[model samples]
Target: MNDQYQALYQTFRWLVPTQFNIAEACCHRWASSSPDARRIAIYYEDESGNREVWTFARLAEAANQLANGLVKMGVGRGDRVGVVLGQRPETVVAHMAIYSVGGVVLPLSAQFGPEALESRLCDSETRVAIVDHASSANLLAVSDNCPALQQIIGIGFADERVLPWRSLLARQPNEFKAVQTRSADPAILLYSSDASGAPKGALLPHSVLIGNLPGFVASQDWFPKPADVFWSPADWASTGGIMGALLPTLYFGHPIVGTRGRFSVERAFELLERYQVTNTFLAPSVVKMMMKAVPEPRHRYQLALRSIMSSGESVGETVFEWCQSALGVTPNEMFGQTEMNYVVGNSNKRWPARPGSMGRPYPGHNVAVLNEDGVPAAAGETGEIAVNRQDAHGYPDPVMFLGYWRNEAATQAKFKGDWCLTGDLASVDGDGYFWHAGRADDVFKSAGHRIGPGEIESCLIGHPAVANAAVVPKPDTERGALVKAYVVLTPEFAHRDRNDILENLQEHVRERLAPYEYPKEIEFVDELPMTTNGKIQRGVLRLREEERAQAPAANTDVGAPLVAPAQQPET
Candidate 1:
């Protein structure tokens, strides 16, 4: 290693193994840490509490076998290997294997129906597809559609046509010639939003990812010892997942505890207590659910937890304080996205925890807030977030993605000259701390005043009767757009009268916010429509609100207040 690398190892001495590739990391842990250190157990409840574990040596062998399997199926360097498994271990192995042998891993969401999954496979020209048995039927239905798929593997039952995961592992070479790939070679392919339109693929290189690793490593508190158990609920398709679930643990020598099934607060509590889980990763929504579901007062249970951190979702001041006082651990928050990995983060006991701020950029990243035209935004001003790339500096972002996969037009559009445009809108405080706003597209004009839905939604969620909320603008003649809120009421308030509840929520909002920002209409719903990744489907909510806005009004309503029935109370 060079002087720079040595300095990093010293700086992040707490993060162990210090390997570039997952395969190598596994091999090192297996060979030196003893047979026990290499074993990873995944606790899955949905499949009849079915549990499975894989040893490091065993996984290294399996990865080699899978790479050979891909090679036999005509996959090669720069080729795309698509995975369609649910939140399962096979997906993890497949990603490492594909990249270990110089292919790119294109992960398809298990939540995807045949249509979405097939579109991605065809778009990526995937040569090999590994699907969970649950999704096999859907895959077969769409098999004839993807012209480039040459082979298929199943994670469940074996078949004459499709190889099972176990069978592939049984016939392994136990070794692979490490591909001497440049840091610039593509390794992962990720998709953008689907409901908004056609999803775009963002391609990332190994070196780009390496550059960004320092930022992620710099902020992690509590040296991740081999005895540590790490868990994260974020999916593999997202950067937060890769950073929290895979990168920190694998690179730092920490034992990770993961579930292949869905995440639950009850399960979270159970696993933490049962396994002595020391470190955990979860979204703010999950944390909120945990706070809501637990029967005892906040932070009542002690689970030997040293730290709990989160990303992708924001944690509130109350939630942050509750965790610290209840569990004896303060929650750390990190910030980053699909384009850049962990650009900024907070670590427990080291970095000062801000109640609501996401904190400054990681020690290694060259990050800045830029105005509409790309000049740096003044402190305390909102602007687009951008990263400056300077190759000469050793402290460059190694984990930035290559570009939008094969979509030059889209990639070119995002680049305002040299800076990588993060569509997220944010404001930097005078202290250099960053505050997240709603997405740029999510901002809308209401009564000629610009509004961000996140602020309204945040206010609604603070209500005692509200559980979760999503706000969108509906078309209106007088205001051009009207705010409509779809809410999930707290369990205790579920049986309340709709009008009474609406009145309470409306009055509450009007008192808390400006008249224009208050929802013109409030709709009680069982649950907010959310993406597979757990983000609210605001577009869907917007469409529902628009339909309600277009609904015909009664003849008597003609002289009534302009608020449509969709918004205004009955005359």
Candidate 2:
């Protein structure tokens, strides 16, 4: 290890107070400390270019009023209150208010359809939902299915059954006392993306925000710089958005920009240039899209971006090199899941980043690659990436989630002894850089050789013709399985001859990666299936391949022939 990183890691200590509350630390404390009530907290702009600025005092006041109103509406401590709004001022207000009232905040994405909303709302037993006009209809449509849902607070519009957000706050006093919640108290209930089955709620305590600080600061290159303005397209409903971007930025008393409406590449650049965003948390998928949309962003836009942290999927060498060359900053890639987040990541300033590798474990987190027997894997050995329940000092890790809400069995299954299994597969090198393998289930045997889709997929993306790709094992009679790839062509190469492009891509992977890892068969697709949070859903593709193997007659294509690409429905 380098002396600089060793010193930082060895000397670091988590100073979690016995009593802590996210609302108090993020909004109320800052509001009360500042002499000026107009200190800006959030700079909000919608897709239409309409803008609004919120001050700390205004945020705290609205939270207090909303807290009082929620109390009056029978919301008590530990109750699940759903905040189904987009990146608007009300979303922030609702989250703070729920936390202030000692209620568990269930942040749901506005992009969710009625079925998706119903499943999560029903699963969490969310009682009162605070929603904006865009999400209210979906929530209301599924309210009948969600028996626990009693009150619906509508932001812009209301009906006879729903209560108006403004009216509810106006009727209550704007001076509610912030709840003194313990550091270990349940604060937020986050649902998993449900790639395997139904989504599970991972209950996070108030100390999670504290646990997230080390990695957050490290990933943002020791954040809270004087002129650091933060922005991210990550949805606040998810861990990457909330813990990675929103909460940590707020805790540091920095102004964060939020925009409403769908995220577009043009809009992202516009916001960065307009707001002078200095730091951002972007998913690898979004980063790839941005890389494709504008290869030379720095030349086109006047950006102040100094640091960027990307997660969700592997950030390949192509994207890594692109960020440094185009953005003038080396993007730090972070790795974590809903249960335990921000545990491992890169800090370019502290330690040099090895592209395509998940950096050493962040300070205060004890992480290792564990074999099936739960023992730490040797250097260059593949295994599940797991985090210890206790830190290196033997103290309980604050970053760990409370447990799965109402599902103890699932929670118990998540751990092997004291290690919390992340279900992700990786291998640690001698230098402590963790290289990603595919998910445990995603890795399969092809001709007596174990192959990970991640390496092959990363190799595929390095090809200029490919915009995004997913590799899966296609069943074969001779070899147990053959490496098959589903590729999404870049806009420039979309209409080209698919047969020639397929051969070129096959050669591209064979030359760069191992010959065994080269996809024996390649299928061009309009788009790969993606989860709502913007992860390429390899499981979906895997299942399709499995089904095709069973019904060979229904799917007779054998070789890397270019048939019409199937259009995948938007998630």
Candidate 3:
């Protein structure tokens, strides 16, 4: 390990619960341990269909080559490099390459189109981009427009002008000088979902994430023994998937299982059994789908699963109970968001599980239920969840991000005196654990995505037939909330076939967005209920969805709009 890494490892020992750098720990484990310990694989049986594996030794070597290749291509300390790859072994290598050089990693979705890719690249002023062979074209399309994108490398396909990954060993220098990076240096940048305006990059230092590991391990039961396999269904584009699962895996030599295709309850179980995954992080909405879509009782196939951890939304009470009873894996639900990061969790280790508690705040961290005025709320009073900034422990050392990349004004506004204001509303009971209330604004969860209802409604209103629109999350077991849009169509849209119109919009959006982001359903109404000022009442629409979903009978209404072949949006 470099001096910088050694210093950090020591710092964590004294200050952080996990006393070692995850990257160094993984490298030493892979090099010195038995060959069996080095065995790791990324299962992709969904689309390509089969078992493909990579040995730890092989991955370590490949990552070394990729790391050197990144350096040779002029990537080094403090530089920003964007990665666009599928959930395969190479994805992990890309992370290693960037970190080894002390460069910051910016992981984007392989599914982002040219336009979305351009937006992120420009905003961060990324220096290098590594894309999957399939997405190289998108990078090339945006590269010229993004002057700061110095080099574009491909993971799978390589040309004479474009370097292929296989040549990293042959063309690049084998000897590399790994930068001894510091705790405060920017190590990762994740762009938040754009709800208010443009997406803002969340810049995080290595120390910020490293500090959360002890609590994470305790809560998720991630350590002591290396889990046989680890997985997180969240996309690499999002920060949760990387920090909450991927980075932690590097702390221990554990193989991870991830699917390159859409998440299926059956496929997830199959992968778990195939890889013998012992610990995992998932969105609870996935839990609902597993029970609904699987053909038979899965407990027989789930012996490999020992821990089921979740976040991005609350662990609905029903799903929490079912997981313990059915899968033999109790749900470890955590609560917090991109701003204040890790606040509370069942700590994954706490048992006799509380009905609604997200567990207590970790040691060194101080949490309080603050009223609208930022003062501590009275006992049993619901208030905005706030993080104490000046506690003797100092934000628990590592459970915080550096700051939002460039939005200094927004940052200052959210912090009131010494507390980091979590816009999330919650309440603390007499016992000290926090209970989640609804969001403070329009942002909500549906189908595992932190969706912006306005974005969906905007697309609906674009159709010539739609004049006004309102969208809301209808709670469902499979996906905590399902997107249900209510639209007031223009007369021209009514003339078109309903089925035809829905089909066209879905196709249009599929072409315009990442696949997981598409809404599951859409509905049309004569007029959206609104206030006197004409602002659509989203709360009222949300209630409408709740009432209909709870009707005392079967809810067979699957209202997906259809489109005629003539006007179907191109994908």
Candidate 4:
């Protein structure tokens, strides 16, 4: 609502070119721009402390070689190629190679099990997979079921039946012309879970990276500052990792640090200190874990982090304050989905960031809170957060995905007229900042009041004893439903008397939030269900509560005793 923000939004323009290839823009051009072509692109370290550095020259050459190899094997434009690797150097190389050949890149998580791998590969009809040792077995296990899968290229492991990554590159020419691709050509096929837990592919165009720039730059506090080193532990398989962190950093011709292993708080701190990382994109779960593991990171490790962008879930006020006091930086919480990402976020430098608010729409995006009838909701009214296909200037938004792969009906259903529905619910204040209510599916009605899990979860997370929490509606006969919370206690508080902890949590919410919003029942659990991308699976918890209600011997006590330790399954 301020004049400065209004001016910034009004002056932004989209400059997408007719011919654009992600590989050319992120790698080859940077390589050829400089005479030496020796600018560092990646600094890689493994769990065992093995280190390697790749310059733009090396990345481009490797991509060219791989592109040639893939082409010789009959892979062409529009063909699907899977990159099932973690945050290693080859992951970046595989994406570049896929883009260079105009093949659709399918970035799969290395942590996926056989069933998950089969679902995505078979759905995408992936022709070839470039994988590391960790993911090779699971991919191979499902390859027989995926008839379209023609070849498997393995890295860091030997198998006579599989093509070695090095051997394939060594036999191919080191220089090949990258296929000319239009800005609207399909570049990536990212699989996200649907309502039924099945994977649906969202095909992103080459211009998707261009679309992500404004929000990325703003969230990272006007990124690419002098010598700005970037790092993120988010998996390269997801949008937050690749689009939000990797591709954006690479587009600016900056070096990004990657480590191959499970993320630990200690390792994260060490890497930030060792690399002097100035910008990072962390998920809310990672931020919370860091807050719990190290209350004061700056005290133990030397850091130069200028900006931290957190998404995937709301970075609650508790975590936001911790970042300011402990990390010496205010984290910008971003909002978007796999189909359309980085649409809404906070930029503390440009405008004041309201903690727990998913800031205003990024420039070049037309966002609004839409009611069920597709009309924009008035201020302070809860509705679905949606983005228009066109910007304020009536230009096509480059950041929007092409469509869900081969699922035209589902794609059509995603939009209400020109507005693409995000399936997330929020309310805009008079000042235009979006306050998250909850996921549309996650919000529930208790008595006559609609209850959103986010506000209660945020309140629970602020409690010192609670490390993380998920709020869900518990089925009730008299009251229709009741607010129920699953709490994950901090290590120090895990073994404390459960009854006392539960009572304390109930009172904490009752004193802070509305009495009706306070959890009527609390369950202490070892951990809540989480997605591979670190989002709490409130759906899973909600389903569990529904099942419990249908049981023959269901407990109906409003003040029931705390349940014994139970571990929720991973979603």
Looking at model 1, report the run of 10 residues with the lowest lDDT sum: 556-565
- How do the residues 27-85 of candidate 3 rate in per-residue lDDT, one tens digit apiece? 53564467744566344443667556766666656667778888777888878999898
Candidate 4 has its poorest 10 consecutive residues by lDDT at 558-567
- Model 2 off-target regions past 4 Å? 1-3, 442-571
Ranking by TM-score: 3, 4, 2, 1
Q: Decide which is better by lDDT, 1 or 4.
A: 4
Per-residue lDDT over 37-73 for candidate 4, one digit per residue giving the tens place of the 0 to 100 score:
7889999999899999999999999999999999998
Predicted structure with the largest TM-score when compared to the true one: 3
Question: What C-alpha lDDT values do all the predictions have?
Answer: 0.67, 0.85, 0.67, 0.85
Write the residue-wise lDDT of candidate 2 on 460-554 in tens digits.
Answer: 88899999888888876545578899998899998999999999999887654445668999888776777555677777777778889899889
Residue 207's lDDT in candidate 1: 63
Which residue runs does candidate 1 get wrong by more than 4 Å? 1-22, 26-46, 158-161, 194-196, 295-302, 391-395, 443-571
Which candidate do you rate higher for lDDT, 1 or 2?
2
Using Cα atoms with residue i matched to residue i, what is each candidate's TM-score against the true structure?
0.73, 0.80, 0.83, 0.80
Clashes of each: 13, 0, 15, 0
- Identify the candidate with maximal lDDT: 4
Per-residue lDDT of 292 in model 1? 74
